[model samples]
Target: MANSTLLSRTRAERAAAERTTGEPVGQGRRIGSHLVLVLLAIYFVVPLWWLAVASTKTNAGLFGGAPLWFGSDFALGDNIATLFSYQGGIYWIWFRNSFVYAIAGGVGATVLSVLAGYGLAKYRFRGRGAFFALLLGSVMVPMTALVIPTFVLLSGMGLLNTMWAVILPSLLSPVGVYLVRVYAQDAVPEEVLDAGRVDGAGEIRLFFQVVLPLLRPAIVTVLLLTTVATWNNFFLPLAVLRDPNLLPVTVGVYNWQALSNAGAGGEQVWNLIVTGSFISVVPLVAAFLSLQKYWQGGLSLGSVR
Candidate 1:
């Protein structure tokens, strides 16, 4: 009886100790997670923070003082006015051109990718494997290495130095096709397609009304990637376009940077260039945030399946 009583007391003591320690253990884990997130936030925000600070400063302020600190004088308003008026308002032209290229190229690439990918995934025909192999091979080739060949081809077609030269190349994205094919194969089922066919739906109708809606998330992904690529594409634009008016924001920014370095555009223009870059980035950031929700929604829809 004494031994039984002692054992019961020990069990109760152990339970009490566990109850007291559990809350601290959970609190410690939460603190660790918060610390990790804080560090990650700092890592991502640091460059943007620096850019914002630098945009408001003169070149002297930029080159002098603490790198992270704001300048003594706020020249942001002046920078905006100068950027807008630079080169007879060429910067605004470049901004519009960027929008045209990004949106047009992105939409074209997404449509082509969806059609090509869905066809490749759902249909089987003679030489299908070979066709897919060609696509995979195209993706493997370095785009930079093909610039010269592309230029020559465009030259032969009398399309070099025109917007067509840039837009045409942007339209043919093997990587986008490949990504769509992979995603569609998993996300879109053959059974659903067969059901559409049984309902007397034609291929075009089925694609737009049925499969395309189902592949919204992948479509958004392709669109965003293609947009960013086209917007930031510098080498191709540099190689193909010599007209200052035809230049996109990336090349236009380079021109500004060059002028600033040569002291050709005056000292104040340096701050203008920095401020322009800061403004230019805003739209891209907005695009990502807007599309990100759609991406998440698509992922959830797929997960539910």
Candidate 2:
């Protein structure tokens, strides 16, 4: 009887696997899916390709040439030179300021989200459900909507027009907290904590030594997201900072754009703006390429583990 039951279960498993992996898809359906993917890929890639070509083109080439066509006069090197040399090399300052804000704010936010999420997930405290609901509700609130109130509060605290104004506001990422809470609930097990307790481990030690390792993928996800968000942030910085030196790349690039569009001959060094924009994109692309493997591992972790 046992052998017969085992054989039936094995057959069922085999059938399920075959249905998922061995079934033949229709040729038309496969082609349609591929075509859709190709179209989407082109949609995203075209903008970056245009940016690259535009950066290498003279201002005349930008206005006169085919929008998607490569410019014959390669001015990429000249554009970069002008970009760095403009405004007493203040671009370097903006670049540094951006890194400082993004990294510090991202790390701070990631840590806070991780701790709050882990506590909420693992502990059954008073107002736990209500607090989490509030958090989720906050996620529905747009950042732009809160900008005015945030500015007011920051001004009251004398943080306006300062780097802290930007960094402090960015640290409250409801989405990161929500994502980490979900991850922590699934990645951490009560049995493991119990085992650590039995082995004479303190709660903090267990969290730091045992649970934190398992929660790495979620941590990375939150870190990457917060960092990118902070990096690309425009409105917050624009609202918070007044000094040109404290401006991030986004605002600095925007300043160049505003000047170029101000009047005729205003577009003389427009290629610098294009080149600077392209340069701003490089760090993000490099980050994505470097961390993509971790994302795959993160997504597969629960299933494989």
Candidate 3:
């Protein structure tokens, strides 16, 4: 009996040892994943690094220096002055236009998405499934493919070459709606809505005062995505806008890049282009850093969760 007891103890000890041995394999996988992430981070960051380095150089220094290295002289102040001063300070106009479009569009899309998503998730109604199917179908369709049709529609309405043309299109974020719907279905409980009704609260009041607070994370996520999309959107703007004054930084930068490459529009403007590129990304980075903490909250709670 003592031998049998010892044998059982030995098996238990072997099992414990095997468990301990397996833990390092998991740790090693984590380490490998971290290493891969670091590599990818570096890979993506290199161009930004080049943009930063190049922005501080003289037009001469840009061509002369090692591509990754800083120039002999730091000319960030001069470069920025040149960037803003170029062509009667058109860059500022583009910057303002981008801010207007991105903020307005982001907010508009978020509001629409949250409302539609919540209604779809919580309410039973006719054509709900079909509408959802249509929404999902829209997501699968590429935005680029619709650019031409959008331009044609805008042209028909006589909205071409206008700020409305950009802001209006940006507000139609199908993916945002889909994200909010999925999130709301999980986050906002029907029980809560029923409870609100028990207190004689109207649906609009419940949605605004209770449901919206719960949907903050999803709302912010959609807003950030829509903002970024509007900021970076190139093709639609290019197709719709003929006025250079209406250009966003994305298109304006492309304009500079084209001139730089073709040497068609006077002396090449590489330094200004690079400098402008560096400045434009700062807002996006700031936004990501600012909004990052909310993403960690659980969506199950229905509040910013």
Candidate 4:
């Protein structure tokens, strides 16, 4: 009886210890995951922080001062002034061009993706499987590989050096279509459409009233993706556009960098470049922040359902 009582006391002590300490393996894993996430966050944030700091510095401060920290002199306002005034304010033109391309391409791609994805998800159509297969295969193909072919095709069509060249290519987003397709399949129900149809609603009416609202999250996601893609597109714009007037900010910034690299004759516009880059990122950040709620809400709704 004394031995049995001792064994029970030992077991109780062990349980108390376990309760106090929790699971060591799970706790370690959580710590490790948090550490990794913190590192990643720093890695991504450092460059942006550097860019912001660099934008606030003069040419001399940018090079001579600390690379990641702020300079003694604040030149952000001056840099922005020079960015606008330099070379007849061409940066404004580039900025405007980027806006045009991003909006046109993003909206167009989102519309097409929504329509195609919704159709693929809801409708029974001929060659649907084959088309979807082609889409999946296209998604696997790297975008860079298509640049040359796109360039050639645009050249043949005499569309090179035009905004259309950039905007047109940005419109066909295979990933956007695929994302929308996957989202719509579950988010938009067949029964909902059928219920609307039974009420004598036209297809267009049904799409507008019943289906489109359900796919808001997917639409916003595609819009942001396509817009950002078009905004940040460097290679295609570089290859297709030769005119300085037509260049988007991405290519235009590179042009400034190339000039800076030129041995002695070319002007050094590093301050302007840094400032312009900072300005260019603002719109995209604002867009994401503004639209974040819709997608987050959708995700929460899905999770709850």
Q: lDDT tens string, model 3, 65-103?
A: 699999789999999998767899898899999999899
> How does model 1 fare in lDDT?
0.79
RMSD of each: 11.9, 6.5, 9.9, 11.0
Q: What residue pairs are clashing in model 1?
A: none
Better of 1 and 4 by lDDT: 4
Give TM per candidate.
0.82, 0.85, 0.85, 0.84
Looking at model 2, which ten-residue stretch has the lowest summed lDDT?
A: 1-10
Model 1 stretches astray by more than 4 angstroms: 1-27, 30-37, 59-67, 264-268, 296-305
Clashes of each: 0, 0, 2, 0
Cα lDDT listed for each candidate: 0.79, 0.83, 0.83, 0.85
What ranges in model 2 sit over 4 Å off? 1-23, 26-29, 264-268, 296-305
Tens digits of per-residue lDDT for model 4 on 1-305? 22323323543575587566544554445777789999999999999999999999998898896899898999999998998789989999999999999899999999999999999988889999999999989988999998999999999999999999999989999988877777777778789989999999999999999999988877887787788888888889999999999999989988898888884464888889899999999998786678786555433322321
The candidate maximizing lDDT is: 4
Task: Give the per-residue Cα lDDT of candidate 1 at 161.
Answer: 76
